[model samples]
Target: MDSEKPREIRIGNAERTTALEALGEHYTIGRLDNAEYSERVDAVTAARTRSELSELFIDLPEPTPFGPGDGSAALTPAARAASAPARIPDRREKVVRTLNLFAGGGTVLVFLLLLALGVPMAWLVFILLPMAYGAIRIWAGPGDVDASGIDSAEQQRRRDVESRRRKELGY
Candidate 1:
């Protein structure tokens, strides 16, 4: 009856996707180099059985997609939050986004108004100014200063100082 032989379980798309994500995370963290990562990725895509997928992570550490009792599931919400790095919002990006929205909306409104007034098509060229300004701002990338001319570094420094003071005062 071949009772000693273990059943071969087949894997599906969901398992493949989870394995791929785990592999990607490992690659991102430098656990796998470009060539090794590419080879493993191709192997993962071709893997059809659970045993085949398990072979890919044999050299890696924990956090395998096929395994149960991974450490991440044991972390408390507060511990997880504390473990994550804090992100400081960039005011320059926000300002540029606002500028883009204003430019687009202004261009559409002006075009509609000019159309309603039966103005010549040549006047439509004026709408290009706001769009051009928006394009320039985007092309410039997130600069050091925001629309208010405030230096982002200075703002961040001031915020750090304030936070330190508050902590020192036990506030």
Candidate 2:
């Protein structure tokens, strides 16, 4: 207590406000009752030093700096840091998925419409969208292609087994 006395000297409004906030948080989480919360808040406002402010939180669990709730309690500190940025969806990814869906559906429709209209450049129009989509996929690299229950490796293995069986049956 004697050594802690020096650490509790003349604090400012900011320190008082911070301690008051901590007291409010303690009250909210049921750590401190209504009367205790009010008393601690008054003490915090009157507190003149760091140690004086520290006493309010002495029996309370440490407040999470990341957020208000216990949702992040299970996460590691690094995960908590990473999760803030991870929640935001990437704009580039959104554009890619939208483009893929539109281009795939648009290609066949455009080709058929052009052909039906008897356009001279129908054949050229027919290949353009598909070619553009292929180029985009190649440039962007593969994405979430496995929407079906089966993955590429499993499909390839089934195909190989079927081919071997057909060959053995002389088909």
- Top candidate by TM-score: 1
TM-score of 1: 0.40
Q: By summed lDDT, which 10 consecutive residues of candidate 2 come out lowest? A: 64-73
What TM-score against the true fold does each predicted structure earn?
0.40, 0.33
Tens digit of per-residue lDDT, candidate 1, span 83-127: 433445476676677777867676777777878888889465466
Clashes of each: 0, 2
Candidate 1 off by > 4 Å: 68-171
Which lDDT value does model 2 have at 127? 73
Question: What would the per-residue lDDT of candidate 2 be over residues 1-171, giving only the tens digit for each residue?
Answer: 477544435777665555555554444434555477557766666677665666555445446222334233455666544432223334445667777787866777887898898988877865787778768767776543343323367545545543453344333
Model 1: lDDT equals 0.65
